[model samples]
Target: MVIGAPASGQGKTTVATGLMAALSRAPYGLDVAAFKVGPDYIDPGYHALATGRPGRNLDPWMQGEERIVPLLLHGALHTTAQQPNPARIAIIEGVMGLFDGKAETEGFASTAHVVELTESPVILTVDISHASRTIAATVGGVAAFEEGVKVEGIILNKAGSPRHADEVKRALRRLGIPVLGVLPRDEAIHVPSRHLGLVPAAERDESRQALDALAQRIADNVDLARVVKIAMTAPRLSARPWDPAAEVHPPVAETTTRPRIAIAGGRAFTFRYAETTELMEAAGCEPVEFDPLRDPALPPDTAGIYLGGGFPEVHAEELSANASMIASIREAIDAGTPTVGECAGLLYLCREVDGHPMVGAVDATAAMGPTLVLGYRDADGTRGHEFHRTTTTPAEPTMAPNVHASYLHVHWAGAPELAQEFCDATHAYASSRPDLKHHGDTEVGEGLVDLAVNVRLPGPPAWMTEAIMATLPGLGAYPDATAARAAIAAFHGVTPEMVLPTSGGAEAFTLIARAIPGDRPVVVHPQFTEPEAALLAAGRTPHRHVLAPPFTLDVDALPPTDLLMIGNPTNPTSVLHDGEALRDLAGPGRIVVIDEAFMDAVPGEHESQIHAEMDHLLVVRSLTKTWGLAGLRAGYVVGDPRLIARLAAQQPPWSVSSPALAAMVACTTDRARVEAQLAVVRTTRDRDHLIESLTTLGWDVVTPAAGPFVLADSHDPGTRARLRVRGFAVRRGDTFPGLGPHWIRIAVREPSVTDALVEAARV
Candidate 1:
């Protein structure tokens, strides 16, 4: 069951949470598992509090639609089969309204997206107060906007009076849509919203009261029997799991010896999805739990470490005061131990979190900030919000050898090999038992990794050759025939055509340079390193125009270049320039090439330049940095007839194939997924309070940051490396040319990740 609203605050969560609570206490002894559709942490908490079960987030963007059914089935079947219950149900709550998403139309991040993917009918929670008859138009628009999306029923929230409920019910019944329930306007039942949507139930002390009251209200008001009948009457699905074990990425090969993988759990690291931890277990390691706040020290048996995401900033004082644990963690990591830190975990591993003295594990300081750094991750494809209360300082070297730390929270595409290597190295130092002894280098702490399973591939994709070949094809033979076969041999996993290689974004630009020929070929500057480079390489003296100082483009400055090249949210400056303005600039005898490489960092697709419908407009997209597939060289140009034709002819046949094509098809085909990503972006933005904090610290911030990164001028004239010693690695302005050195580009990370930066930059 997917429950959602036209937008947030329509009471989808309240109704869903209430329903779960009511059912948990039912006489049926039903085993029910709750899940959220996107990257939400708050609603899941409410679900968990209501159901007395862990509510997993089933994000198709993060994992896949295949994983959705399997995860749901796994959570349901695993728990029910073990319990004394014979019946079970799974309830999935959604993000936004039905049919709102990142695509050309609504439903981009809408519950409708999940409905299509899961084959689940929607129970829309419409906020019906002022609007009455027009509600029909709203419902019709949602139902007709996309075919096959089932809006099986509607729940009228905040109905004015009993008469109002009757009127609305009669109207919805006329449309043949069932009005599941009508919730009266009860100020006593309101859930609070903070910077990051509604406050997560875990963080709310009154959540139990709210949930209990909500459940009683829903039980009293809603037709519980009808809902149960509707639920049972809905087509009974095969008990088969959504993602059968055989269908998921196979478990890693296990080692003869078990490695004790020390994981930071408790509340701080609770943000992690169960799949990642399960994968680690399947890989031949025993995951041990330790709280950074409560635990006094690392478990004596701990070998490797996995620190998933949670709220470190909220409990900064407690974490800071845990001196013994902090020292033990630092000692473990410093002594050649392998560690992976995500979101809050990343913040905890830093030198000092916020203004409080911390473990000093990594060589960085953390500080509090008032902005959120959020987005849908290009990796893992999960959409949810991230809100940690810290950021790292001297940010240049956020990564260290054995310890990998970043605010970038993703599940797949993570460096599993790095994890494997850390496990291998750590196990080398552990005390060897006769039964546990296996490979070389077994010692003290090293024994922990002996149990770990290594699932990482030996190297990156074979299509990684695109960037190299584009740069130095002459080093090898007439690469076509031999390179294709050699690529197949090298990968041993895929076909050659599946690897359409390019020379960075330069090759993509080269394709555009040749396709759009004219006396005036415009180059969008401060956006990417290559658009101008490619035009220059192609011998087209490109016309150039910088955006206005505040980072917004003055539409009047846009000249008709016959061929115009513009970057959405112009690159180095990280300005989310208006898409409509770029559309206005395109016309007859003109070709507009839009670089959307940075556009994915923003949450919604509506913010992207791809929305323009001009026949001459061509948009170039890259998965490199966004998805950390930079080494993969997977990018494509989307354009109208003549432009696509010209660009296609310039490329060799069967350019993009196996993996690159697969990853691309996997990413672009699902519009619901990308919008789901936006929830995360919004999460980061609200939690970090990045813009507000930066502005307070005297930095000029670009408003309405639609891109993942923000460009700002620092009050101080410190080199980025200088900031590195303090623990941050920021993109300096000099690399962007026309921008002065005082300017820096900060990637929107988790709130805790940005908080450290804010502290480091404190005036």
Candidate 2:
């Protein structure tokens, strides 16, 4: 749930962290997961201290909307994994004001946008120390100004007296929004601030007491039950929970073997994304975490080292005192072990940090000074380093190959290749069991009818092609998603913040594999193999729920799992499950992904989950098939904005080319949508004719095929070969988890192609 305020300095952090602390106490006993919206790393520090779980940032602009819910779920579920109890609630503290975002006019990354995406009710905190009745008008304006944002409750901060609180509550009752609590003006409740927001909770002595007192004040004055109820009222999210493993994308060759990369951790290296280790693992490298502040040496057989951002400045003396640890790191770096350091990590590698001796991996000294170098940087010509935000003094370059130490804290998610490059430079090799990355495309060679692939032949219409070509001249500029996102949002009737355009539907699966964090991920089989393949690629083995003959989904018969994947009008079998039944599979802690790649092929798009707004539901749609733009590889994912953000965080910058973004925008337009609907009708008709002819020829065809393809039981191994000899190609179903060599998948075609297939069957 989102905790926002009318404006800055309205006590949002105080209310949010206090609420988290209060909810986590005895009576509630809710394992609370806290998040801070936007790029600031400081607020999450306070959130972690208050909730006893790591605080995460949800930046819509930096990370993307597809990742938010997945990140939220990852943090929430991860907290459960570490603790004795599971997290029962999630609290997201807003940045700036309720409606303020990346810009003053647009609410793209605002608290309200987050609220709309998660479908979480909002509790607006208003500083009511001066005003009484004006609080109602202020909240009412915020609630009514936005279409989807729901202001369920309010909290009046710094109320003058009991009478003042009553006056505000009475005024708010007129608007029908509940007043959850009131904070009287108290000097003891305020957290101290410094140069960069509040001094991190770790740096302060009175942090715990201050948080406890703040929580106590909230408990004494607020309606705790009402707050919990409001949070619980947030609908079950259907997007897959974010998994650190899914966020990592190691090159295929590296999957089998892994190199041990020792990453510095502990209180000094506290600022790190969990995805960093996951990314290393994805690149076929094992990330062994070591604490420079405590561990005497790096992990055994360490081939590389990584030092992330933290407070080396604060613990300079202790770190300097650990001469053995510093010496070991220095030796490893000097020995040409691939090493990368960021911010405090860079500081630790210097000759000295704040006049204290360090590892001396780099030639320069890093002394803490009054100057601060901070902001998002696109490091131009700084070999190997990509994009990041850093707050540290500059240092001289090191002599060793593959040794990079900088103040910039780069997020590997936005630049996965950088991680792979680092691993390749180190030549770190690790092995794993062999797995096939096979798909239908591998079966269709040159000089064939090309029935093996599902995409429509002849590709997208001319008008769509022209639209894509129009974007070619603009390729010099980075692909701007604003227009495409706006178009998709208009098509789906959601805010622009709700749509995330990906490279392809396959990329969507890969993103899901890398971002959505979950244990016991279940994939419904005989549908699409990509989901499982992507998961396996990310070092996750999904449990396959192989359906019988008709390939019907029995939601009740399924085992309990946190992340579930199902295809709409499933591939190969072509069975569309009931939409309500699909929705029923989702609950408080489950994410249900409906792969609607083939949904547009179904007439009227029946049972499509795209337009729904459930916190736990994610709908993945592909324009590649319907628009016949497979070669271009375009698609979009719809879900809670938070989930979109998490998935998007795993993607590299400009992952989707300019032309593809234009195609996405064009295909979602009114005229293009109409053309697509007509194409679906034609495809359905062609599919029916093909199914009938195959059945008449005594082939055991799968009935009621709703996709653009039909599955036939041709038990003989020679069937595909025989068809190929007759100048036709069909997909071998055996490669798919549940089906065997006997089953073949044939794409729909005109009567001319259907007649060719019939003649080939006779051969």
Q: Tell me, by lDDT, which candidate is best.
A: 2
In candidate 2, position 558 carries an lDDT of 88
* Model 2 lDDT tens row, 1-763: 8999989999999999899998888778788888888766667777888888878777665556787787777777774446756578999999888888864448877888788778888999999988888888988898899889888898889988999899888888878888887889999988887444566676677889998998899899889999888988899999888765565455555444466798887777766765566667656677888888887666755678889877787789999998657766775665467888877787888778768888877777766556555444446522122222223344544345657877666656445566768876554422211123566687787888988888875678888889998988888999887888888888888877667889887899999989987666788888787887887677655666789887888888886688999998888788888988898777668888889998888888878876647577788888887777888888888887888889878988888888998998898888987887888889988988999898877778887888989999876867988898888989887767678777899988897999889987986
Stretches of model 2 off by over 4 angstroms after superposition: 78-81, 84-86, 103-105, 130-134, 170-174, 204-210, 249-260, 281-289, 363-400, 413-763
What would the TM-score be for candidate 1 when compared with the true structure? 0.52
- lDDT of all the models against the reference? 0.63, 0.78
Q: Mark the regions of model 1 whose C-alpha exceeds 4 Å error after superposition.
A: 80-87, 103-110, 233-257, 379-391, 412-763
Residues 402-463 of candidate 1 have per-residue lDDT tens digits of 77777766643123443345455545533221121121112113212210111112233344
Candidate 2: minimum summed lDDT over ten consecutive residues — where? 381-390
